[model samples]
Target chain A: MARDRRGGSPPPTAVSTDLTRRARIRDAGLRLFSERGTEGATVRDIARAASVSPGLVRHHFGSKEGLRAACDAFVLERGTEIKERALFQGELDQPELLLMHRYLARSMVEGSGAAASMFDRLVQATQLWLERHAPSETPDPRGRAALLIAMELGALVMREVLSRALGSDTLSPEGSLRVARAKLELYSQPLLSADAAARARAAMDALGERLDAAAAGEGRPATGAGDPGG
Target chain B: MARDRRGGSPPPTAVSTDLTRRARIRDAGLRLFSERGTEGATVRDIARAASVSPGLVRHHFGSKEGLRAACDAFVLERGTEIKERALFQGELDQPELLLMHRYLARSMVEGSGAAASMFDRLVQATQLWLERHAPSETPDPRGRAALLIAMELGALVMREVLSRALGSDTLSPEGSLRVARAKLELYSQPLLSADAAARARAAMDALGERLDAAAAGEGRPATGAGDPGG
Candidate 1:
């Protein structure tokens, strides 16, 4: 059955051909969707971008919403892929955070990915995934681990924001690289020494306990230590 | 002569609209800008949103771009107002990190200021501003201090990105609020204690110096921490 570009179900298959075709469709979708936005983009626009027929899009996905769903998955999987490759490059607990930041910066500053508008959808998907997987029992260490990892990445963006608000300008490519490197370096050091990491974990655990207690109190619990909350 | 929104030139002080009309125009612009992207929106939209005529929109803003530029400034300024107010609310040595975070989150999550997509523009604008101003420094403590403050606010959006990437489904109101609070808690902690902050800064500085040494030295740096980069 042929599908319209507006939305449809992707064809079911385990073969290489199917995988390659799916990739083609997703790549095209990312470019067009980012450019036109979710509501603005049409299936034909995506098909044209992918060099595939509209029927092929329809034949694979059930509808426009389905294609969007697939695109969401594709962007996410790619984000995961970037995370993996950046970390795998060398031995440092963190390869230069700047390098990783650069990789993301490339996606955000240079390409179709720069739209940054799609972030809303990605966030929504993240919530649904959390609900399904973060079951009560084991703490879902995997998801928790990913969340903490993400906080570090967020640090770079934070640095950029701070720089701009005060400086009235953005980080040039080289400077951003330098600052991001500095942040990543700072983030990396404690981890390098297992002794320090254990100490840090203990401190964090204590702090978390205090927070839990304070939160339970009549009013909001005051977090101890330096306020990183700003 | 009519004044332009980009601050090209203000009309002579003698030519003035009553304060009420000025407020009405700014209000109308904000409403339209949030609903329609800065690009998608027109003067007609602003006027309509304000229940005024397009001529009135021009009379107030001078042109479509002018209105948009003004709107952009308004959104940025409004978001920063609470922080600016709160900065003076506490002692000079250390401020309440939780309060700061709450103020920022309240602005983004609750304000009439542009929501997420609109925020995409604000975040990028801040980055743009950082890019321009950060390297313009001349070893002045004032510049550095200002930059640090800006970096702190930047952390808010940065943390949001991190929480989302980890698959927590942080896009919705509840999830976004939850993640915002967590990040607020994390980043706000440092602002509360002077000694803790001094130590953290010392650590970051040392790490930065070491990174510089490493970069000056050898081959590629180690891979970054966590699964994304690894």
Candidate 2:
């Protein structure tokens, strides 16, 4: 029951394993989660596939839920950040956002399946996150932030599908990011100005806090749900 | 089968059913299509829910596939038209773009099941459309036009899911639209001045005759078949 006690570095655990082994667990988790559904995959299965002990998995993640959450964060937060950076490698020279969009698309379609699997899990998890993270204040956190992330992920994947259909081969890290960039440019007009994007992001952070509180079953409900598209 | 002949202008054989009946069928179809995946639902089921005859369903559309195609057109083509119109609505005054985006969001989220179904169909249909419509000439229509439409549809749906999680019930067609417009602006930045959108769109029109046609299907083949994440 001793802790690794290492700050910054993932601590040593009760069960034997390494960082790469943990990644394998994530890789295995993404595949199973995407194919069956986040709710469908079990921790034991992921551990076995990763060639690790279930005890090790538990020691690392604390629980199956913890592992799922970690996988979601890893794919969406880290992967997207990485892909975005990769896409705009030289936006100034390219000038054409579409070209950059095409390049980033490579990350989604042709990127490692591990990336794609984590992506699938993130989309589904966004909902659960809202459920878990809703604020306790009145009115919901206004899922605008969640939706933006969702749209980004969906667009990323759809770009992959469209690329393959268009005959761009080998959905890979180096494939037609130019084409993907061009495709992404189709979305440029609607982008929030830097100021607006900031405000929106802020609103989202505030909303997330509210959602977390509310989902905890405390606080005034937000009036944002007055909509009745039903 | 006897025609409704309700219009009295003529015994409309093609769209013979009145708007009311057609509306009923569409509403029923949209609902069922959402609940049941494309492969799972049937015309009989749709007609039964609409309280109409299967004959009417068949008469309105040649078959189940045709009906589904019509549904896609209804959601996608019509939705795009709405989206494009909203782009300019707020440019003048009152920030109408926000309303427009919200309205678009409603169409996307409320129409989620339909949008999801449309996409599944579109994924395969894009291929068929290319095959049948791809002209055997020297000018290839730009491949990205249909792809653009498809991507936009995904964006709209993505935003709706966001609205759902944040519990933003005010996700009107107009409000959601603003969000989409903002995103599209960022997406299309490079093309705004250059008329790239226009050129790309026209290319799609001309591509039929002169597609790269590089030995049809010569484009890269998908490598690493089967889920790589595994």
Candidate 3:
């Protein structure tokens, strides 16, 4: 046979077909799961949507839960690729910022199933990225990441709510980016003087140690693992 | 008729019965609407859940939309009462603050139905309340109220997402409130010295005016009334 122009030889028909079938099922599952929730969609529903036999779904993914996990991994990888690429340039222009907000907002609202996991992955990626690029010595990196994520997520997830509350469509891409940038810039300015930030950090550190000890005394993990009230 | 100890006269059976039925239907609608979205629920589902006949639902509510409206009004009123009461004591203790955050978070998540409208109403109520209680001359009160609402809603809605992202249970009432308060305290300290906030506000004002004029030229309302993109 003639060599493939794309480079590598084509996989065996059986293997390629298997890959296609699995991907079809995964993509179908992602759409449905994103629209409804994981709990809301059934294996039969996904199989039917994917135009595949239910037995095939079980054969490839084992169970509905397994399929969901696969979908989560797939979507998270796709989403992370986009986000990392977008912020890779270091500084963002207006369009780039808007794109970031839009992607994040969509992921947040389509929050059931893989989207939720995707969000967590995105945050981790973002935090790691922030640490590498904008390494801070004064403001705690983790705390700063949490705040930044909260602000971005808030703008996207609550856009309509914000629009209604603010008497403007603050959720619109342009509108949201504008407000978000302003707020981010404003917030980036140290709310407390450097001395105060250090003092606050110290106080929080002490509080955290005490809480951890208290939790340990109660035979619970310090990071609130045993707290059922959450 | 026998005299009633609790009142001057007993309510007629028909009126009281009607009131009881209406209230029963309303409460059931509120719970269902909060749990699912307005569109996700149906008149039959609500009536069945309420233990009332479908005919009764239509007789009382006119339609499903009508019932949803009633539910929105009811939930909003209840929520506002709790929030206003929480803040009424001037300053909030941790518990009080937690309560406020919990209520707001629930409202934000239950947003697809009446909660969206309720958020707008809450913002209006909050703005009015702030103007009366903590009138500010330097920072624009309306802008400040919008920012505060955005921040609170952000924390609540994204708490789970935040928790997942931050590798902590940010949704735990106490934990979330603690982190939120710290962040809030930090944010409340003027991010920008007085001058920066004014400058940002001015820039936004000019942008707003330009958009408003453009909207007028297009024979549309300035505040994005006609934009369907959102």
Candidate 4:
């Protein structure tokens, strides 16, 4: 009965074929969704894009909602792939960083639900990376991770904004990448150093302690404790 | 003839009155425009918001376009004020920084023309600041300035994004301030150090020189001069 459901294919033993077909459907869905949006792109359109029958789309994913979720996962995996390549495979050369920034800039402004979710996932990935890689004694890894992600993505768009402000087209593809590399080199010199990262982590911990103490004192009579003389 | 246009008011020798009236109109325009957008808000709506006559709105700004431009200028000036206060008036306390960040996060996502232009002006101000404060020997002040501004504003929104990613309400008034203080403490410890700043400036100059050399070789064919072995 199951094999018959798959249009009389072999007894469902071709796992590789099934996996490849699913990937094809997802890739096609991403393209169509990016072009026309989820609501605008129909199941038939996605099937045509993937060069498969509508039954294949239905068989692989129950509905458009499922297909869209798969597309989101694919985009997130791509972001993770970029991060891994940059982290483990030696230094990320200028071109490689450029590719990552371009993708990010595009996604940041895509205004689609998937693009928004993809960005969220990237931030979460940064948090996870910090937890695993940060010094065991590091405090406020979440806060530190947020700062790193902010600077990384910041280096991307700031290139364009600065180019516009400075009355130059340094924001053109090649030029922006050049500017981005220069900025990254400047920021990363300190941020990437083990000593600096540790120092920053410690600083964050101290600040958090101060904040917590201050919060606790809200009910205390401030006249004495807050006074410098006291 | 200009004096005659005034509705029986003094000859407008009082510069203070002119300034006050202009500010009132601009403030009203900003509020209305932010709430309803430029096209959605009318001159009458702005005048009503300001408790002035429609004629006064026209008198201060020739049309809706003029009013909107003034609003942009106002927003830019506000941003500059925050930066100046934070830089000069000792360390920016958490609340002060939080206030500025809230305004920025709101402006960045406003999707209004005023917001976009205001952001542009803020970038320009950052460029000017770097050119003045960075080491005299530093090259590519514009690029460096852009990097600084990107980090600054990126710090602002990344707080919100981080809160969202962590599923914490770090964006609530007090919570956001706490989160912001932690991140700021982490970034500022190194950024405020004279030694780090000087090192960063020197590195920027070195990268600029490297980039210039690479660009100069773009049109040259592969030859003995470019070959590492040669």
Evaluated with lDDT, which candidate comes out highest? 3
Per-prediction TM-score: 0.44, 0.39, 0.55, 0.53
Q: Highest DockQ among the candidates is held by which one? A: 3
Q: Report how closely model 2 matches the true complex, as a DockQ value.
A: 0.09
Which lDDT tens digits does candidate 3 get at residues A1-230? Answer: 12222222444344323446678788677766644445556788888887768887898799988887786665456555554454454333334334444544444543455556656555566567555544445244454456556655665556656666666667453454355444634343433454555565565566567666676576432221110001
Q: Model 4's A-chain: what TM-score?
A: 0.45
Each model's backbone clash number: 64, 91, 0, 0
Which tens-of-lDDT digit does each residue in A130-227 have in candidate 4? 45433333345555555556555554444444455545555443454445444533443332244544554465456556656877875321110100
Categorize the docking of model 3: incorrect
Rank the candidate models, highest lDDT first.
3, 4, 2, 1
Instruction: Please rank every candidate by DockQ, starting with the best.
Output: 3, 4, 1, 2
Q: Which of candidates 1 and 2 reaches a greater DockQ? A: 1
RMSD of each: 12.5, 15.4, 10.4, 11.2
TM-score of chain A of each: 0.39, 0.38, 0.51, 0.45
DockQ of the candidate models in sequence: 0.12, 0.09, 0.16, 0.14
lDDT of 2: 0.45
Please compute and give the TM-score of the first chain of candidate 2 against the native first chain.
Answer: 0.38
- Could you tell me which 10 consecutive residues in candidate 3 chain A have the lowest summed lDDT? A221-230
